[model samples]
Target chain A: MSEILLQIDGREVEARKGMTILEAAQSAGIFIPTLCHHEKLEAYGACRICTVEVEARGRKNLVAACVYPVEQNLVVRTRSEKIDRIRKMILELLLAHAPDAFALQDLAKEYGADKDRFEKEASFCIHCGLCVRYCAEVKKKNAVGFVDRGTRREISFIPEIASKECWNCKECFPLCPTEALQAAFVLTKALFSP
Target chain B: MPRINSATELEELRKGILSKRDPNKPCIAICAGTGCLALGNDRVISAFEEEVKKQTLEAKVDIRATGCHGFCEKGPNIIIYPEEICYIEVTPEDVPEIVSQTVLGKEVIDRLIYTDPNTGEKAAHQSEIPFYKNQMRHLIGNNSKIDPKSIDEYLALGGYSALSKSLFEMSPEQVLEEIKKANLRGRGGGGFPAGLKWETARNAPGEEKYVIVNGHEGEPGAFMDRALFTGNPHSVLEGLIIGAYAIGSHQGFIYTRHDSPQLRNNIAVALTQAEEYGLLGENILGSGFNFNVEVHLDIGIFVSGESSALMRSIEGKNPEPRPKYIRTSVSGIWEKPSNLNNVETWANVPQIINRGSEWYTSIGTERSKGTKLISLSGNIVNTGVVEVPFGTTLREIVYDIGGGIPNGKKLKAVHFGGPMGGSIPESLLDTPLDFDELAKLGAPIGAGGMFVLDEDTNMVDVTRFFLNFLTNESCGKCVPCREGIRQMLKIVTNISEGKGREGDIELLEEISEVAGAASLCALGKTASDPLLSTLRYFRDEYEANIKEKKCRA
Candidate 1:
């Protein structure tokens, strides 16, 4: 693999071929806040919180540091006021969906996003893609997958029908970043109580 | 007759036995699934045996304990072959008359037969019964025909022929090609192509590749895998052996949960039996392929269901998930190339190989080809395992197969895909059981656990219960899952307890993003699915709890 030269957080650095921006930043001891990227599984740029401004081949754009492989002469910004604001907004949006989610709360605190201004949507879907990734990548069950387009897109067992292949194992619920998947025990009480 | 080893051989064996016996001889198949066993089906079996013995009609009568018949509401059940006479709710005391009248006289037992709640007509035959008639039972249909304990019975039905053919005739590459042709995907939760996984492990740069069978069914109210383990262990073993051969693996392990003692014992017995018959160890079936299998009991941790966690348990480490970038097929279970598949996924291999890929593909939707075995439980009439072709609608499953909500209760939301799966409201009940279909609805077909919720259920409380579960089960290695789930739980609990704040919902969405984006494993990433999906579809319920300080039904 050829060594790729890049500028991270305005500091010049060299990275190996195919190394992600996150990897490049981490090797340089530059911390980029992230939520969905795991070192063990394939990089899922679902959270989009790890976005970074990258200038490659004279073209500048924001991309997920976890999934974006480093190229030669790539200029990357790990931290900036704009990036911080976007990161904070992402956290705030996540909080709107899952207010009690401790992980997001901590990230909010770390990013200095203490209060959210947007009207809270009645939804638990943070759109993390764990359920989609697991179904397609891990279990290979393919009984469910991501369907439709972005924003309106969500995980389903089938395209137009509620899945019969779904064993109801609840594996996806735990993998869901938002509490879109509800457990039966909670639903039972929710149904009965006035 | 010589001992049979495969499903093909079993079919021949069945033919031979049928050739000699009187075609008119009554064949009684008792429901021997674990659920039925819990209701004292064993005693019922014994009573029928004694009655047959007392009547001196052993030669003319054949009684076998078959796998789950799928109708669990009215077990212990018995279905007489040829006539297809269906008997439900049979107790030990009802055995004498069953043997004397049904077995001896060939008369239907009206009292024990299932009466359709709507029609008021007694279902005398298994085929005529609405529970069995309304749904497709492609995978589990065999459960009604073969005895799980008797490999001979399975072989007599031609069970292991697929393995035999794969070993003796087909090359490893050929096996992979066949699987690819079938388009058989993993039946666990992840629906990646099974053949692709085998090919990856086979072609990966390694001298040793391992195959691990995941029997760690930790999902609440799910028991399909357990039923397969307990009832038909050999079928799964045969599939594993084929997988091992394809991947060039010498050793394999069945990582079973500790809770199921009967399943564990059944698998042990099957392994011992296979080994004795030269079907499991040291060059099985006189073929050059050498494969060995062992059942590794898990310590009953929910996290063990995760691939990394399952691998950790196999390696004598605490059941905790490792980082994700390293693919198990590349570096797993002692850092060797490993192919890990759930019990049901393995079981489908032999069927696909034997029946041919096109036949398998013809059953389900375009993307999701073949049938899926789902454990249908919670607020339903028929709480048992059903194998239906992919793309079957939730309405069909809950109504046709599950016999709808019990006691005429209105169906509110159907919780598919377990904890990690989202709940579908009644509006989306028409969604089919396919990979892409459910994904579009913001839910995935998890390990095939479907919990039907009645109109009386509360969505907010349901979200809290799952949050509580994920919080407790979090490996705690990542801050997002550990702290994030805890905070989500607190907020959801507050809403459920009528103490939610105006800004609480926004707070939850933020936390969900962090957990989804930052969590190291699937556990944390999807920990918020229940809450998120509920918020998307049932936001009114959350708002009612938060604003009105009450759960509105």
Candidate 2:
């Protein structure tokens, strides 16, 4: 791979041409927050928490650090006023879904995000797709998957697959940012068990 | 009929078709478009057929059920040939008199012609009608001339000549160059240059490239794509085939909506007819350039209209849009170079090739070239598909062609692009229909869905209505769009219900910035456009609902 030279938060970093800004920052030990991204699996740019300011070829844009590929002489800002506001609003919005999600609460404290900035929906699932991708990509079980679309989208454990494989391999349980995954798995087990 | 083998044979076939048709034949062209069909043009069509047979004038007076005539408000519409006499709101009972007086006697019917409601002036001929007169009709003008299902009629109208010209006369590079010089921007939305996109797909390192026709006209008020595709399917197919040749693609896909059986049937028939005529498939017109096409139907969602999502749907996967940091032209549909354009954009390709770039550039404005097919709906007096050059002003479309607003209600705002687009207030009605011009006024001419709102229409309710639609249609892949729209909808709904707080507008703007900037795809990015544009022009209405608990509409 050709070596790519770029800057992250004003610090010089060396990355490969195919590397994403998140991967480059991680290699250089720079801090960036993420919710739906995992190193073992492909980048799912669902949660916009890692949205960073990027400038290349005299054009500046806000892109998810996980999916935006690194370029030669690219400038990336991990934190900015605009980015922080986006992250803060994201935290507040996600909080409405899962009010007690510990990961969100930690970010909420840091970003000064209100727990009830909007109406409380409390669906308990933020639709991170972590459990789904983990089951499908890492474990190769395909036990959990996304169901429906848009605001009603949620992760559901497939009863046919989960009942057979998820009994011993609770691998996706801890990956959930909230209790929704475990709750879903338990519900599926109870509903499908003979 | 045997398959045409060469340009000479194609020309011979065209001549053979033309020789059989007489220019002065008294053909009763009935409007059987979706609008007219809904208004019971099918009964009228059957009535005309029976009347012609009963009168034993079937051979002399030809009854052709053509496509949309554009004056939808007055449909079931018909235009008699030779004299070009126009009739509106035709019924089954009127079919007999139409056949006798108009077709047989060549006498114009006084009561059936278009009478302007505002001016009380009568227009007997189709050209005299203000709606048809104002339009340039470069694309949809043929709807009233030819029957959609008849390949012979299309050939008589100079259909596949563009394809023949491109294959026999011009090289692919020359074809691409002409399109580039013509500056034909995408009519679907975004107004991106079609030539540049084709060049990128052509240059992308790949042996297999694909082109797609986005027939998924999911915009609520937009039906022009359907009118053009269904009425003149061959025109769009011819354009798609020519585009495939120019882009050096062996395969192309037509992705249309699963609804509208007429549209799907017309496209299916068009494809089969083109293949049989050797205008498509292997060794098209015996030019040794092999290409084929397949028709795919969307699973029925607005998001499926997004280029990436449409490509994904074609791949038999869930139709979700990917971040287009890398253009789809470089990597799409199983990682092959793919060029996707809307149905209207593809339909314009054949015209650019048939007419030289200079002739094509003679019309429209500085950047935008050629005519745009706009579907006018809502409070307008005339709700139908209109085709006008790009430089035409909104006032011309609204006042002249649209016949102004109905019920003498004052015009409020004209919303373009459906749920994903913005609106322009009455003050900006003079803004040209050019892509950049309307975009500058915060209302992009997206797929050309012009919805007129009257004085009684509340802008806040309208914004909320569009948001509610998006909230259900959103694919929920990203946080900024799904959750952000949820919160924004909550605020807007509350504001519309007179429960908005003092800082709700600022909060909505802040969320719009984040959603607009941080979202992964175009759906999320443009989801807030309606709210932002309404807030831009009609802030006082929102303020009135919030501060005084009253609606200003």
Candidate 3:
């Protein structure tokens, strides 16, 4: 791939064409925080923690670094007051759902988010989509998926398919950011796997 | 019956249809729109038919079910031809009197006429009525003339002539130039210029581009698009074909409300009929340009109206809006350029082409050209869809067309737009309905739903209602919008319930700014608009809720 020159946090970086801002920042040795993003999978912009101000062609707005591909003459700011505030707010919300997830707690502490600003939601999944993606994309089981939508959206297991296809495959267990899926994987393995 | 091969054959068909219609024939046009249908207009229709047969006036008189006549407050309504006499709240029992007296005896029915509140005078004619007067009904007025089910009725009113003109006469480039010169902004909330979006999609790379007609009018109290789509769907379809021709898109989609089966069916029939006549699909009217359209229903959420999310929904994915860094107009729906416009914006296309761009530009304000369809609802004497020019003041709409606030109550404020919109206090009622002017006053003409609030209405409560609506409707994929709206809703609810803290408003503002700036899509970015605008204008109400623990009248 041909390399394109771009600026990240006032420093120059050469990134291959079709490389995302997050990837470019990583290659340039600049640290940028991310959630709902995995190197082995496609960019899932669900968590929105890697938001950065990107300016290109006289236009600028906040974009998810994971999904936004780097281009020639592109300028990106990885951190700012607006960026931090958004990240903090997102963490504050995330903590309400998966408050005990150690990575989320550390991220929250780094961003200095308030703990009780929002009410807690009832789920441990936190909607990272890592497990869902791993199960669907890598494992090729198609056993777990997101159902419903909006605030009520939750990751639901199709028991009929999971019972048939997921007994031996513990592949999605190690990929989850939270340990919510480990017990289910063990239960499926113990009950169904010969 | 065969596919029309040339514009000449299309015109000849239109001529044949028009020549067969008798102008002097006495016809009864009954509204079968959703609003009228709810009031059992179908029964009224059957009653009229039965009464007409009983009276032996079947051959001489024609009773046809038309679309919404716009004055939905006084339905089920009927407009008689040859004199344009309007009858309101028509019932099956009244059908005999209407047929015997109004149609046969050539006399007026005083009890059925709409009485003017101010003058204490009754109006029988459609044009003379205050609700229909003092306004420009360019797009919606056609609903009263044609049956939405019949293409013949639409043709008799000179419908596809605009398409014929655009396809046979003007080049695609010329059509784009006219739309650009007309400065027709999207009637969708953002008010972005329609021509600029079309030009972007037309010029964007990739041979396959898609044009979308957003019929998901899920905005609270906004049934204008639904009326337009359900009443005269062919107008919207004809407009879509013209837009596709201009944008060089062979494929199009009309995404409408999934709950409205009538709307879905009407559009389905329109598409089938249009295709049958060679108006759509494979070399439309022998112009060597081909276009085809499909109808898709929405996921039934308010946020699905966002362009990006709607595109995702059409792609058979969850209707969650992603950050539009690529700007959906250029790269949307399977990563191809897709040009999407609101139902009203597309409906205005035919009018712009039929009348020159100069003619279209002559109406409305300097910046926002063309007349807008405003759905007048909430605490008003007349709650229905009304079409008026852009520069018309809120005062005129509230007092004249809306028939003033109900039950002699003092005017409190007017809420424009829907959940993502703001309210205009009665003190600023003279604010014109122009896009820039209303936006300058902190109110945007979102979906053109003009909800009038009165003395008893609580401003804080109004804002709280909208926030709660958005909180539920949000896709929850993004953090700021999902949590920020939830937090704002909590604060607003606390303040409304008299348990608010001292720093609650400041906290709300901080969250608003973050959510408005950082959120992934338009739903997240503008999620705080209703709360912010209310705080800007009605700060005293919030303070009262916090300090005094009481609501202000």
Candidate 4:
């Protein structure tokens, strides 16, 4: 495979073509914390935990390392105070919805995220897109997709109704890094209604 | 009578059987799908058989037990072949008239046909029904055409030809290459490239390798895998055989949930038939390769679906996921390289191999290739199993395929994935079902579950429902999943009950971050998806519960 050159943490590194910033950083022994990115599965940037500062073409911005592909001559910083603060803010927002979620708590602790920084709002989906990726990419079952645009966007099955195409295979539920997508069996059992 | 060994022989037998049929007699096929079985289809079938014998028309008429007909609401359903006549909501009491009129006189039983709720037009055949006609049945359509208990029915349909080809012609490497070309990914949930997983297992260093078919479907509203196993066990088995050949595994197991007795029995019979035909045991069909399969019943537990947890259950241990740092392909199932795939994933194998990979890849989007089977349930009209190509729009599925929402209620939200999946509002309906596209929208494809939401559903209450599930199902092996779920549940509960504090949302975010970052397994790591996605998209619903002390839509 052809290789591309990139600079990370002030060091030049050679990476395989089509490698993501996170993959490039990992190969160079630079750790970028991520939740929705799994080695066995494709990249899903929903969790936003892998955010990193990228200096490319004289522009600097925070990008999710898991989904953002690395280009030649790209300059990336895996860690910094700005990146850390943004991660902490994202974590704080996630905590408001699912404070009891252990995965969210661990990430918050690692980033020194405290409970007082943001307002608490309960939510199950961290918008990691694992379920969407699993359906669209892995299962090739387009039964579910994004229903809205921008901040209002989220995942859904067709026509807002469960279709016959859904095998209820439950493949997407576990892969979701947050509770956005869930298992009905678990949910019904929790309800104790039947 | 001699046993049928292959599709060719089975076809010959079928020809003989059809020739023997009297022109005046009709063929009655009673659906024996799980849904109908629960509704006492067995008794209806036996009653019809007795009525035929009583009328002394046994020589002319034939009675068969077929698989699911898909319309679960109207089962125990029956279909009379040749005329393609369908009978719905059948009972033992209706057997005599069916035998006398439909079977003997070759007349349609007026009361048994399906009447459309709107048009009031009775549908006499399965193909004419709107529920089935609007959707493509592909893999599952075969269920209604065959007798799951009879291996001959399967063999009559060119089954096992793929296995023979793999065993006699294709080397393990060659088989893996074909799969890679096909672009099939895991249907079990993660959608990892199927070919890549097999290649990894084939190349991984280990003296022994094991292949497992994950029949332990723990999803609440999902029954597609179970239906496939019960209605068409051969398809799944053939896929497994090919998968084992590619990975050089001599031993394989079908791990089914213990709750499914019919599926378990169906697989057992199929295994026996395969062994007898020299297709499953050592040196199958004169080929030098050796392969064998066994069925293992699983105690019902949600986490057991995890690869490591399933492996542990098969090894006679408690089912709990081991850390992911140790890949299962390298250190799974008695510390041997192992390959585990769900039932649907295995079922797609023979099709990909037979049709060629390029043909399969041509159906879906650029990145996601081929069709996916989704289990549709909750607040929908045409609820059952459906298969569609990747990148198909949600509007096409929900409105066109699903026949729109029932009772004309205004649409609210749609839940994709499952309890662990996220809920999407109605605004993003045009989004296509592609992997990267959905990821950009903050949701991933889950094991195909789509729960439709209506005005009656409370988002906050729904979030609480999932949190409670994660709280109980969490294995407590990791702090993030175990404790974080508890705290999240409490906060959501407080919000729902009008006791939520102002900073509760912020606290939830903090906990979600820690859990996502530090959890050892996928369970702990992604347990907060429901809360987080809801917060991102439907924060107003949560605010209404907390700040406004209301559960407004």
Candidate 5:
């Protein structure tokens, strides 16, 4: 395979053609923050934590690096003041919604997000579509999917399919960044068994 | 009925159909559109049928239930042909008088005619009405002319002549070149050029390409698509078949609102009839161009109206927006080249072909070509759909065409584009309705929804209302959209209810910056539009709520 070239954080790096900006940055010893990406699954671009300013197609757009493909003459700024401010605001939003999520708490502190700025809604499950994708892709069980839309959107386990197909050891439970998934599973299970 | 082998056969069929129909006979066109149906047009329809059958004048008189007349504020409407007398707010009890006096005896009823609220003068003809006179209805004007269930009515009015012209008269590249020259832009909020979008899919490397009609007009205070689909479903179909031929796509889909059963049924019947006549299926009109269309109702969510999210819904997945690094036109719907145009945009193609691009381009502004269908609603006198040229000022739209605000209320502001759009103050009402011009003034023209706000309406409450709507429909896929919209909704709601703080505006601006840049799709990116525009123009309302803990109203 031929190696492609792209500029990331003022450093010249060689990458494969199909590699995402996050993957290319990682290969060049750079760390870009992310919440919904996993090497084992497809790029979802849901969390938007790993956003970077990219100039493509004659326009400068702040795009999620986890799903943006590398192309020729692609100029990427992985870390900038504008990027930091946007990432901090997104992290601050997450902290207000899911304050107890451990990964989110760590990232919020790293990005200097003020958790107290926004009123606490007392809810979990930021709906990153991680566990949903894990169940559908890796486990091949198709037991979980997203239900509803917007803030009302939640991860719902298909009880009929979960009971029939997802009988193996619960491998996707640990993949969740928040404890909301565990609580959801219990609630869904209770509804089905009762 | 055999398939039309050539364009000559199609023209012959049109001549035969037109020869059998009488132009002098009087017909009763009663509006059966959704709004009219809600207003008891069903009873009026049945009453007309019973009275006509009872009097045994069925041969002498024709009664057809048509679509919207664009005067929904005055519907259960009845219009008599040849004389062109229009009667509004008609009930079943008034049908006997109408059938005998108007249809049988050629007389007009005095009380049933629409009395202008301004001049107090009664107008009986559809052409003389204030709402229909000042405005140019190029697109929506067809609704009052045809019955949606009968293809013969559509056929007689030169419906599929454009499709026949596309297959026989022009090459695929020439058909595309004309649309590009006409500068027809997408009416589906995005406003991307339809010709350029089609060119990308047509040139993309793929053996299979798809065309989609986005009938999912979910924007609030907007029902023009519903009116068009329920009124003239074949215009959209003919445009779609012409587009598929131009883009070299075989399969097409019309994604519409699930709640619109009438729209879905009309489209289904149109598709079936077009197929039975060998106009839609393989070897269409014996031109060897095969195309098929299917109707897909949305799962019923606002985010499902997004192009990428809509594609995901059609693919049997949850309607969540994916990254648009790959344009849906280049790689969409099973990673194939897909061309998606809004309902009104597709409906314009047949007209552009039938009348020539130069004639079509001679209508709207220099940049924004052709007329736009606007649903004139909210605080207006004559509330219905109005189609005007692109450069028509907001003041003209609100005053001359809309009959000004009702109840003598002061026009405070005009909101366009629904939740994702911004509000402009009344002072800037003279701004021309151009795509780029509207975006320049904090308020962008989105999907042609013109909502007039009067003086009594609270700015903070309106901002909160739009933000709350975006929160319920955000799809929760991206962090900035889901979380950012939630935070903004909280602050805006606080300000509305007299619980605002000093730093709320700054915080909202900060969140707007993040959400606008980092959100996955247009829904999240522009979720802060209503809030930001309100803050820019109505900062006094926000400051009063924040500093004094009281609403200005």
Candidate 6:
């Protein structure tokens, strides 16, 4: 792999080819908050908490750091007023679903986001896909996956597979950013178990 | 029919097909497009057949059910060849008179002809009609002439000659150069240069590449793609083969709506016929080049029309979009390079190759070349598919071609690009139809869905309605789009229902900014375009709804 150099938060950082901005930031010990991203899986880019402003070839654009690959002479701003506003709004939106998620609460405090900024539905799954990706990518079990789409999208455990595999494993239970995954697993257990 | 093995053989086949057709034969061409079919043109067609048989004029008088005639408001339309007399809204009762008088006696019917609602003038010929007169129909002009299922008819009309020329005469580089020279832009919303995209996929370091025809006309008011694709499937197929040859790809995919069976059936028939005639498949035209096409149906969501999502769907995965940090032409469709163009965009390729780039460039503006197919709808008198060259004024399209707003209502605005696009007020009616010109007014002519809104339409409610559509159609993969649209829809719905607060507009703008900036794909990035443009021009209505709690509309 070839070495690529870029600037993040006014500090020069060196990265390898095919390395993502979030990866490079992490290698250089730079702090960029994330929700749906995990090193063990492919970049999902669902949470969008790691969205950073990038300037390249005299063009500025907002891109997800976890997915956008690093390039030489690229300028990345990990924190900006616009990015802060976006993160704050994203947290507030996610709060409507899972207001008590500790990850969201931490970010909400940091971004000065009001938990009650929007009305609450409280389905409680932030749709981070951590459990889904962990089950599929790391475990190779395919026990949990996403269902439906858009705002109605949620994680569901395969009853047949969960019955065969998850009862003994239960490894993905702790990866949920909110209580919705556990609730879903409990509902599946109660509904499908003989 | 045997597959032609060489360019000379292809020409011989064309000659054979044309020689079989008589120029002086009296042919009654009935429009069988979806619009006309919905208006009972199929019944009219059977009526013509029965009349021809009952009058014992079956051998002498020919009844041909062709494609869309473009004058959908006045369908089921019929045109008699040799004399070329046009008739509109013909019923089964009038088919006997049409067969006797127009087909045999050469007498034109006055009641069935197109009469100008304003001038009380009658137009007997299709060319003289006010709607068809002011427009240029380069792409869809042949829709009324040829049966979509017949490969011989397509060959008779000089269809695959462009493919023959590309295969026998020009190299792939030369073909790419000609398309680049023509400056052909994609008609599927973005207006991105198709030539540049082809060059990218061609130059990309992958031997295995794919070309796709994006026939998914998911935009609410856009049905012109269906009209052209269904009416002239061979033209689009020929264009796709030519594009595939240029891009050095053997496989092509036609991604279309699953709802339209006619369009799908027409395409399937065209593919089989083309393959049978050696216009497609192995060593096409015996030029030692191989190409084939597969048809993929979308799962019926607006977001599936997005390039990445469409590619994912083609791969049999969930139809969710990924960010285009890398262009699809560089890495797409199982990470192999892919070049996708809209059905209308592909249909223009054969014409460019046949007529050359200079002749193609002679039609439209400096930047936007050739004619565009606009599905004129929403409060307009003539709600149908219209084809006109670029640089035609919006005023001409509305008044002359569209026949203006109905019921004597005043014109308020014209919306373009559906949810991802914006609306322009009547003050900007003088704006030309150039891609950049319409985009400059914040309403990109996306897939050419033109919605003319009358004075009674409320802009706030319109914006809210689009937001609601995006909310349902959003892939929900990313936070900003799924949540931002949900929240924005909530606020806009409240505003539309006269429950708007003072800071609601500012809050909507703030959320729109976040959604526009931080969203995953173009669907999320442009999700706020309708709201922003409505706010730009119609802020007063939002203010009135919020401050005074009343809708002025």
Q: Please provide TM-scores computed only on chain A for all of the candidate models, following their numbering.
A: 0.72, 0.94, 0.90, 0.75, 0.90, 0.94
lDDT of 3 by residue, B1-553 (tens): 6678787887788899878878988899999998999999999999999988887988899988988898999999899998899999999889899998988888999999999988998999987899998779999998988888888788888888899999989999999999999999999889999999999999999999999999988888899998998899989999899999999999999998889988888898889988898899998888888999988888688878889989999999878787676878899999999999999999999989999999998998899899999999999998898999989999999998989988889998888888888888889998888999988877889889989998898888888898888878988787778778878888899998888879999989988988887777877777787787888888999998899876654
How well does model 1 score by local distance difference test? 0.78
Instruction: Show the lowest summed lDDT stretch of 10 residues, model 1 chain A.
Output: A182-191
**RMSD of every prediction:** 12.5, 1.5, 2.3, 13.1, 1.7, 1.5
Q: Tens digits of per-residue lDDT for model 5 on B171-247?
A: 99999999999999999987899999999999999889999999999988889988998899999999999999999
- Candidate 6 - CAPRI tier? high
Badly placed stretches (over 4 Å) of model 4 are A1-194, B1-25
Q: Is candidate 2 or candidate 4 better by DockQ?
A: 2
lDDT-better candidate, 1 vs 4? 1
On a 0 to 1 DockQ scale, where is model 1?
0.04
Give the TM-score comparing model 5 with the true structure, all chains together.
Answer: 0.97
Q: Give the best candidate by lDDT.
A: 6
- Give every collision pair in model 5: A150-B475
Put down candidate 2 lDDT per residue, A48-74, tens digits, no spaces. 899999999999999999999999999
Error of 1 at B507 (Å): 1.1
Per-model DockQ against the true two-chain complex:
0.04, 0.88, 0.59, 0.03, 0.87, 0.83
lDDT of each: 0.78, 0.91, 0.87, 0.75, 0.88, 0.91
Q: Write the number of the candidate with greater lDDT, choosing between 2 and 3.
A: 2
Sort by DockQ, top down from the best: 2, 5, 6, 3, 1, 4
Error at B73, model 4, angstroms:
2.5
**RMSD, model 3, all Cα superposed?**
2.3
TM-score for the first chain of model 2? 0.94
Please provide, for model 6 over B1-553, each residue's C-alpha lDDT reduced to its tens digit, 9 standing for 90 to 100. 8878999998888898888888899999999998889989999999999888898988897788888889888888888998889999889999989888888999998999989999999999977998998999988989878888888888888989999999999999999999999999999999999999999999998899999999999988899999999999999999999999999999999999999999999999999999998888998988899998999999998899999999999999889998788999989999999999999999999999999999999988989999999999999999888999999999999999999999999999999999999999999999989999988878989999999999999999899889888888999989999999999999998888889998999999999999988989989989999999899999999999998887877
lDDT of 2 by residue, B515-552 (tens): 99999888899999999999999999999999987676
